[model samples]
Target: MENLNIGQHISRRYNEELEDIRNRVLAMGGLVEQQLKDAMTALEKRDAGLAAQVVERDCEVNAMEVAIDEECNRVLARRQPAASDLRLVVAVIKTITDLERIGDEAERIARMVSTLVREEHSTRLFTQIRNLGHHVSSMVHGALDAFAHLDTEKSVEVWSEDRLVDDEYDSLMRELMTYMMEDPRSIPSILQAMFAARAMERIGDRAGNICEYVIYLVKGKDVRHTRVDKSG
Candidate 1:
């Protein structure tokens, strides 16, 4: 491992601090991923208790967000880091926000799962819902993997994968719309499905946002506010 080169005695402390921040961000990402898994399992099993637990654990995610933020702020204020250190700190700040939002989306999906358990749904719709979950979950995992590895190519790949999730969401909506049009009784289940799909779509959006941050962290460029010109 390379030393921080801040004179002699304090280099170890600096290295330790940086490593701790990275680990904390990874831990937060893991927590959000686990929350998504728990939410999906609860939906698949129709386990209200597990769904409620997911909702309750969202507070832990929020706390992790705050802690990460504070650590990043401290690093910036104390170290006055420049170049890659600056990029890493900024990336952690942005990435944690994305992770926190993903956690919220997971909780939202869990609540919808509870509704799905309460309401009766046709077999076909249930199968489609499961398939949608699988896609969104893969996107989440891909986004996190891209971030952890700092692979800009993988991040861009994940960003493009958002299109597939959006297409699936639109298709699901159209199917539900047809069901609602054909039978008025299907409206309630359709509404729940719509909310669930919307939540999953938002999760994909946030995952893309995380991918953008990975690009920023690696390349030291802000890809969020402006469009890139490829023809130059």
Candidate 2:
């Protein structure tokens, strides 16, 4: 039947569009992942040049977010996708927003690196901050991997790491406060380190947010504010 043929064509086209959106999201995720990695590398090496590059690349990340968002909107308007398709678009829109915030946090870290390069700071504190950066970077990568694979188990694993990140952040804050109190002259550098640590922790949170969106997409459940039962 001609009507049946036309239906098949439209269905195939819709699937193609969905796949295109997914690929674009993955591309955007890759860029954000690189931004976080480069920012940390620049911080560790005190490479101002690399930090500048990270900052410059953030504009590309921003543009990707805008482009993907527009495409999602267009798909919604044209296709009026139902059920799972609609959920996918909505989840991606939310995930992209979190990804953009993660990019912003990475940029903040890069700027902190620039300031830190000019200041004479404690080597031990910088080492700890670098360790935190490494942890958060791993979390980001895991989150993106989970999204790409639609693996709910991996998503939950990434989500569970957020508590560790928060604990490390608190411990670092206390240590930094002690340093500032003992030596007032170290306050400037310590303050920058504190800001960098906070940014790293926030990145972890954003990564968890992405994981939540992934779960939403796969399970059609809102787990953002609800407590996840790990016992099962």
Candidate 3:
């Protein structure tokens, strides 16, 4: 758990602000991560109470995002940070945006759980989606770990992992299509499952995006839309 030691400054207050914002980002990341876990558990267990809890926690996620944005704005306006400091702020902004989007996706997944549960879909049917949920859950968690350490190497590891998530999602879609073709009556519930799976896939992508931000924060290079070597 090595930090990049990014927040040091001559002014104590300025240093505190930067450190505070970074810590808050991690705290928000923690909350979003928990929301994702709760959502997935709710989906798997068909627990409407837990699903509702996930939806309710989304507002807290929203509030944290708003507060973090304001803190970044204050830093930008007052400090006018440059070089690595500016990049750190920029990366924080981008990371939080993705985290908030991930929260939204989790909320979407939680909402879809009720529909899938109502249909009483078999556990065997959720095979791919559940697999994907776990995959992306690890993706999201790895991404945060990388950010906490400011480790570009780990970031690339998480970045390259997105490929597997995509592959699994495609497989899930094909399976759902086959189910719909074989039994027309399953289409409605299957479509709900498909939507939930899509949300999981997007969550993986967002986790990759956070890794990109981590790389940018460390190397000062924007890696968006670029191929991250899995061999790295």
Best-performing candidate as measured by lDDT:
3
How do the residues 1-232 of candidate 3 rate in per-residue lDDT, one tens digit apiece? 2234565678999989989998999999999999999999988887888999999999999999999999999999999988878888999999999999999999998997677666755455665578899999999999999988888899999989999999999988999999889988878878888888999999999999999998888777778888875343
Please estimate how well model 2 matches the true structure, expressed as its whole-model Cα lDDT: 0.86
lDDT (C-alpha, whole model) for all candidates: 0.81, 0.86, 0.88
In model 1, the runs with Cα more than 4 Å from the true position are 1-10, 225-232
C-alpha RMSD values across all candidates: 3.6, 4.3, 2.5
Clashing pairs in 3: none
Tens digits of per-residue lDDT for model 1 on 108-209?
A: 978876676766663446566777787778878888888777778888878887889899889888988898899888787778777877888998888888
Of candidates 3 and 2, the better by TM-score: 3
Q: Which lDDT tens digits does candidate 2 get at residues 16-76?
A: 8888888899999999999999988888878889999999999999999999999999999
> How should the candidates be ordered by TM-score, best one leading?
3, 2, 1
- Once fitted onto the true fold, the runs of candidate 3 whose alpha carbons sit more than 4 angstroms away are 1-5, 229-232
- Worst 10-residue stretch by lDDT in candidate 1? 1-10
